[model samples]
Each structure stands twice: as structure tokens, then as C-alpha cells.
Target: MSTTVVEVENLSFRYDKRLKENILSNISMTVDQGEWLAVIGPNGSGKSTLAQLLVGLIEADSGKIRIKNTVMDDTSKWKVRRHIGIVFQNPENQFIGTTVQDDVAFSLENLNMPYDEMKFRVDQALDLVGMSSLRHHDPSQLSGGQKQRVAIAGILALKPSILVLDEALVMLDPKSRRELLTVLQNLKRKENISILSITHDMNEAALADRIILLESGKVKNCGTSEQLFVAEPDLEPPFPELLRRELLKRNRNIPNEYMTEEEMVNWLCKSRLTV
Candidate 1:
């Protein structure tokens, strides 16, 4: 059985005391160790607010959050945050150092880590993000994708058990987005890091182990891709599945299976001779 890295129970929060509305209402969810959980919602649906609550940026008006079974309160939130790292949407806003190495080293310095250990971790993190070659490059000199990777490397330096992505890929172009996703996938497999990705992009959400749909500050649905894809209209199938369905419509006898585009391309090339 997998261990639960995070647990939220009956969580609720509101910004204004006078307002009768809650930004998040009775929200409950769990993220297992090494699992990828995607949170999706329309604008103003409390997705970002949830991220804030998870990272202790804001307090919940009601309910509880547990990280590694440690209950989150004012007293424990600081320790809880140590196990959770967050990466935001804009890469530039997150960068605090003049260069890639310095940016990755900033958090370690705050923790007052010894020089040798800090240097080792910073190097490892930069290498993990494939940014080691650019350690001396100024953050301003890198592309948007590179800058985002640098931000992620900064988080990686913390060696947190969980990573919270609050629309971290929204600012990137298509190719850059794919590259970052690949890096994340590697982290999940290699480091056993749990991922909570809050995204509006269905394609990105489709790649997760499970999806949570939020609307009007409440959970509308939560399930695996196969389950939610049928229940929610907004989530279209990946390109391969779409093509597979279209081919079936034309009386083509292709096998019906959930696959990525690359897999479909290989399948077509090997089994179906007709281009």
C-alpha cells in the first residue's frame, strides 16, 4: 500500500470576514507518495488559494491539513513547509539571485547549512534540472523555459518530499512546457517526490495519475483520467486517443487503447502498413 504524503479534511477558507462566500469550501483530498495529482478549475475557482493554503502562505478558516501525518497549525506550519516546496507560474518573479547557481543556493543559505553540504546539494539540484552548464549564467539571460527550470532547481535544493506547482507552466511555450513536464516525471520516478500540479491545461492534467475538478470553490469531480475524462466534457482525450476514435469512425480496425502520440505513431508504423 502507498503512504499518504498529504491529507486535507473538511478544509474551508474565505478571504473577507464580512463576505458570506468561501474561496474554498469543505475541500478534502489526498496525495500519495510518488503520485501525481492534478488540480484543475476555471478562473477564480480557488485553485490558487488551495495552493497557498497547502504551502502555509495563508491559513484555512476551518478544517485541517496534514503533511507526513504532522497536523498543520501555526506552530507546525514552519516544519510542514520544509517538506513541501512550491513553484509558481512566473519564473522571473521567483528568481532572487543574480545567477543560476546563486538562485539555487539562496534557500540553503537561509537554512544556514554548512558550506560543503550546501554546495553538494546545489550542484545536484542544478544537474537534476539540466542547468549545470549554465550555473554561471545570469537568470535574465536564460529563456523563459530555462528560467522556470532554474526556479524548479531552487525548489529541488530543499529536497522536499512534495512539490506544489501553482500554474508553473502557464507562462511557457509548448516545447518548453513538454521539457519541464519530462523533468518532473523524472523527479517523481527517481526521487519519489509527490506532485500536486494546479493547471488549467487539460493536456497537462491528462498526464496525471488522477484529476480533481474544482468549480465555485467546491470539488465537482475527482478520479482517474479514464473516469474523469468520460465524466467531464472539458477534458478531451490525448491526440492519440482522438485519432484512434476518428480512425474507428471511418471503419478502420485499429485497436482501441489509451496511448500517447509517440506510441500511436509507432503502433501505426509497425502494425498498419498503410500510411
Candidate 2:
């Protein structure tokens, strides 16, 4: 079994136009296969930059990245790209084919997969994302969530071992978002792929096996979601203002964080029974 599926060492990168300061600095991390890593950070924390660097979409000024034991350098990076796939934030920008099916089959065509196998894989990917019924429809015609599903299927078609999502679900409506997440959860369990999602949705973060929090291009917290939320005295509520207020009502001095609703609910229910 491979313990380290992704490894980053002393990684730092800067935009070509920007000089002197780096967007990411001295970052080192390891992700085991079959792990789900949720990257949470505020705007301008370099989350998107990190994603691009990981998958070889962009090269770093200095550092090293290895995917599934293959080193990434200028010459070999492109070769390594075969195992990495990214689902960017914008659905509109991601859809390249005239219709959803074409877009999903696009990558396999580039890889020169046989015709019979291509259709089978495309159908499987679409079915995983729950977008099979819309395979013939134009990508632009679908709703935000549906479009994201298409984008996901396109990536899944490649059958990469690593999945990078840069806020791919942010634009969807709540119900749509929930539906996609359900689909994603199923994929994760069945595929055993290493998942890295760059997002600010703390609610979604609750579902992650691990969370890496960033601030000003530096790691602020790296631990399981339960660990970081409770590390801070006021970080428990990932939902919104209303939930925070409710937690505080139970105990005037509610500690900083708590992971998942189950943890909070269990505590609150016990506290009430004792009272």
C-alpha cells in the first residue's frame, strides 16, 4: 500500500509579473491514497495557486512535487500530468465540447482510447455524476449544478488517481450543491482516489477527513476538521450566524470550535439532560 500519494517539499511560487514576494512559501505536506483533504482558506490565501501547482498546470518558482512516486520537473511534468485532473471553479469555462457527452469523451480521445471502451467509460463517469440523461444536451443549457456534474465527469473519464477541485461547487444553488456533494461522496468511496478540494465552505469542510487552513500564504492549521475547529475558542459553527447563536445560548462560554453537527448536538443534548 502506498502511504504517500502526493508529496510537496519546500514549495513556493509567484506570478510571473509579481517579483520578490512568493504566493506560497516553505510548504510541505503529504497526502495518503484514499484520503480526502479539504483545503480551507479565505480569499487571497493562495489556494487556487496551490491547486494549479499540484497538477502541473503551472510550474513553481522553486520546490518539488511528486504524484504517485513520479517526480515533477519541467520535462517530465507533462508526462506526470496524465495522473492528475483538475475541476476548476467556473463551469462555463470548463465545458469545451458542443455537448456534454463529447466533453466527457474528449480526454479519452486525446489518450487514444479504443472506441468501444471510450463509450463505456463515458457512460460510467456520467452515471457516477448523475448526468447521463443530459449527455446529449449542450453544456451551456444545463444549470450550474448540472454543469459541475459534467465537469466532474470529464475529469473522472480520465480515471486519474488524484482529484483537485477549485471551488467547483460554489456557484450552484443549495439543493444542487447538496446533490453534487452526495455524488462526490459516492465517488470517493468507490474510487479510493485522493481528493483535494479548495473551498471556503466550512459547511462542506465538516465532511472532510482532513482540513488544511491557510492564511496569507502560510499554513494556519493542519489537522482533522475536528482538531482545528476545536483548537480555536470560537470556531465551532461552520454554518452561519444562526447556528453559532444557538450553540452559545446553551453555554454562555462555548469553546472556540467543534467539528460536525453530531458532536455539537451530542454535547448540547447531554448538557440539557444534566440540567
In Å, residue 100's CA in model 2 sits off its true spot by 1.3
Residue-by-residue lDDT tens digits, candidate 2, 58-136: 8888879999889888788877777878998897887779999999998889889999999999999999998889989
Question: Model 2: how far is 133 from its true place, Å?
Answer: 1.4
- Output the number of the lDDT-best candidate: 1
What's model 2's overall lDDT?
A: 0.83
lDDT of 2 at 17: 44
Candidate 2, poorest ten consecutive residues by summed lDDT: 233-242
Could you give me the TM-score of model 2 versus the true structure?
Answer: 0.89
Q: Determine which window of 10 residues in candidate 1 has minimal summed lDDT.
A: 232-241
**Poorly placed runs, candidate 1 (over 4 Å):** 256-263, 271-275
TM-scores for the candidates:
0.93, 0.89
Task: Please list the C-alpha lDDT of all candidates, in the order they appear.
Answer: 0.91, 0.83
Residue 16's lDDT in candidate 2: 58
